[model samples]
Target: MTESAEVECVVVGAGAVGLAVARALARAGREVVVLERAGAIGTGISARNSEVIHGGIYYPGGSLKARLCVEGRRMLYTYLDRHGLPHRRCGKLIVANDAAQEAELTRLAERGRANGVEGLTFLTSAEARALEPALRCTSALSSPETGILDAHGFMLSLQGEIEDAGGAIALGSPLIRAEASGRGFALHVGGAAPMRLNARVLVNSAGLSAPAVAARTEGLAPEHVPQAHYAKGNYFSLTGAAPFSRLIYPIPEAAGLGVHLTLDLGGQARFGPDVEWIDPLSTDEIDYAVDARRGDGFYAAIRSYWPALPDGALQPAYAGVRPKLGGPAAASDFVISGPEAHGLAGLVNLFGIESPGLTASLAIADEVAARLSEAA
Candidate 1:
């Protein structure tokens, strides 16, 4: 016989967003339990990729990404300061390689301003080069608010908040299936200690496996779950000293922010996250290995803005897959499906939470909390 338990709330996935959502729900007086498939927290999407806190520039105005990123960026800085977490407001520059691309920079600046991002400045080729002497660009859009942070540390802080508030994080516990049970959800969790849980509130913030989780939800209609797509991004670390002090980016590409340079808190610079769309596969089957041959393309992309980039400086770093809703050419907004959309009480599902997720986590938590409250 499987052991059965009960909880006031259950949050699936222990990534940054899930932890944040659990923190919000727990702090709001809800008895929350977070389920993580991995043995440790933040080992998935939250663990990989550039830890840059976006400045709400790339997303469309009024979208969840835009609003939550701007709001969460502010909230994140404050939370980091209060908790004494490690972070840096090192800023970034979105550079244009030629005059034609300069127009796109203007459009981005305008969009950034419309999204309420402060400290945006347009820079000429000379002005941009003055800031980063190694940079080569026709023009650039400077985002002083963009920065990098300790992602794992931030997630740890969120976990601390949840646990301090009397919530529990069940590591190695994956929700195998969920069904609607009297005004709540019946969750079958799998791991070393398999058990059944009856939860008054259910939040599926499962990151890459969100769609799969939703599909297992018995009461959620099929149409409510969107098809999942994966876009793998590969990063390459610089072999020698980094020439630029700040983050350097090229004009946006089809599925990613182009091969860009981002520094860790320790000042080690790495470039990458070039878009590589692979066949749709389960998260378990998706490859996270970085291909060394891909560096051939990275050299050309990097040298477009940093002409001094050496041939052998690029080394295989790591790779992360974005949980996407669309394919190579199409982009989608962060989907926070709630009771209103699917008519499921006390349940919320987050889908396609890609870039800016770490930056927008707190704000997304608040939104999720609000939706649950309204459902209640």
Candidate 2:
């Protein structure tokens, strides 16, 4: 498609969120196109971190991540099942090591219940320990809804739906700029055959690049754009299975959950995501190599919950960046700027869609579609 031509929708950034928007649009009978800066989809946050499906337990009640995560967690399992996507509802345990931490676990269960999380229950330390003999805790909350999935494969499934529905995803087509055209907008896409595309609606799901894309989109105000921060978190893998059968997590930190335990399809375990504020952001730097020395703190925390954890067992696995809405000392809810928020026509900007983003992709897409449909 060229600048002179027009489609129903043009989705920028082909990560999980972008692909989900494309899939939803195609399913809704719209001719959509996805422009990706990477050679393939899910190269950004989608590929790097743990594939844990969040159970919407952490956010404040009625928050976007909380609501969508709860709804999305349920929707995701269905999508995975219907499409034969690889996943397992391995469940999860939020452990509290002592009296003080036990209060935190109670707070989490209450928040989960207030956020409409189903099947959440409190367990005594002994109950928790029995479930995973290696686990030691003063108390715990069991979330049966959480699990992991093949994230890349999930994106592929969304891409397949977009293609099968007569939509196209222009790989390597980085969004250079966009201009306001007639009632729609014109997009300058960067790629092998650099070209332009016109669309009636635009959805910026550009993950890390979201702020820049919104600033570049036609008829958008730069001041309205919030500064994007790259909050980097590192992960460490266990050479063998984690003694715990379910995913285990510490209470959430300011920007993310504390170093938590997550498993893969193979049931191998990894823990991590220590937060660090980044200055000059560069997502391409794939420092998958992690430092084993950091395990000292992890050992301290894990030992608080599982004291018998053998020393020198946790190895550095990988790390990923979170596109955050807040910096230190702040915890901001996600920003999903639609036409009303920005006063633009037929556009939606997804900002601060970090942690639970993978779990909330489908529901978030449906929301973006509903918002855009009203504007369109």
Candidate 3:
């Protein structure tokens, strides 16, 4: 058997959440090492989807998603300003195309206020059109706190912070399995070296593969690991200049927030993330190809809120898969399991982290830190 390497902390996955966890630990004066299966960081669920900083407007009241999103969005803006990251508080509008949908908009506004989101304004059709000029909504709820950020740049900043704190990130190092050791855990890493690591603190922030990774831990209770679900969302980017200045979202669908228009930091508009649930086992090998034919449905969806949408304006852009804990027809909130839930000291597991994950990364990190501290 190879000699087991020792580390103070081992963070599985190098996505936004994983990096944040490592940063928090290192800042607390703990030696940390991040292990990533991919060749680069932030390539998993973190790299996919709209890089929008969501306001805490949609989650159930008093849920972790609601609380963390609200807190994280504010902390993210401050962090971006301090780091000089590329971002903009461009804001967003949740539109109601017909009078029937108007009630939904009001409900969303109420939920936003309940979640502690400020600057939410309900606007009439004419008032909404005045802001976008091309909007065709009967009413809308404007969320001024919603915005977009350079997700890659933000991940890079977190990476820098982790490194600056004397931590290290090992690329191309996949964690094969883990087992309970004396007071810590033993992690087997699959790579050219195929080494073993005994870490005093282990964080499984593996994003999409979190459930599977947790199952591989030798001593972890099986029931504590939630069932995994994969939902593939495809995006179609606008071929020409974007029509609106801010994000335009229709009333949310049952499975997701619906096909909405979001602009990147470069001001390029894209629509999509229409949910297509896939089998959980196939998640590792799921396809991310953007079907150009899907653009047909997007045209009708976009025209509902922007009747001025021109034909053939959307082209196949990209696709990203979200890691979900619940299957279709079910809604699941973020699950951050600490030792108390699983009886695994020095370990933390994060599952069902989907939308608003980017917006809630920092707060989630804080939660992980507190959980680990409690166990300590």
Best by TM-score: 1
Cα deviation at 237, candidate 2, in Å, is 0.4
lDDT by residue (1-376, candidate 2, tens digit) is 5444568799988999889989999999999999899888899888887999989899998789899999898999999999999999999999887777888888989999999988999988789888988877788899999999999999999989899999998888898898865577888877777777778888889998898888887678787799877887888888766687799887776777888888889888888788877755455553555566777788886676667778788887777888887887778777889878877788888998898999999999999999888876
User: Per-residue CA lDDT of candidate 1, range 226-317, in tens?
Assistant: 99999999999999888989999889989888999999998999998998888755889988999899999999999999888887998999
TM-scores, all candidates, are 0.99, 0.96, 0.98
lDDT of each: 0.93, 0.85, 0.90
lDDT of 2 at 129: 82
**Which candidate model has the greater lDDT, 2 or 3?**
3
Number of the top lDDT candidate: 1
With candidate 1 superimposed using the best TM-score fit, by how many Å does residue 187's alpha carbon deviate from the native? 0.6
lDDT of 3 at 249: 94
Better of 1 and 3 by TM-score: 1
The list of candidate 1 runs beyond 4 A from truth reads: none
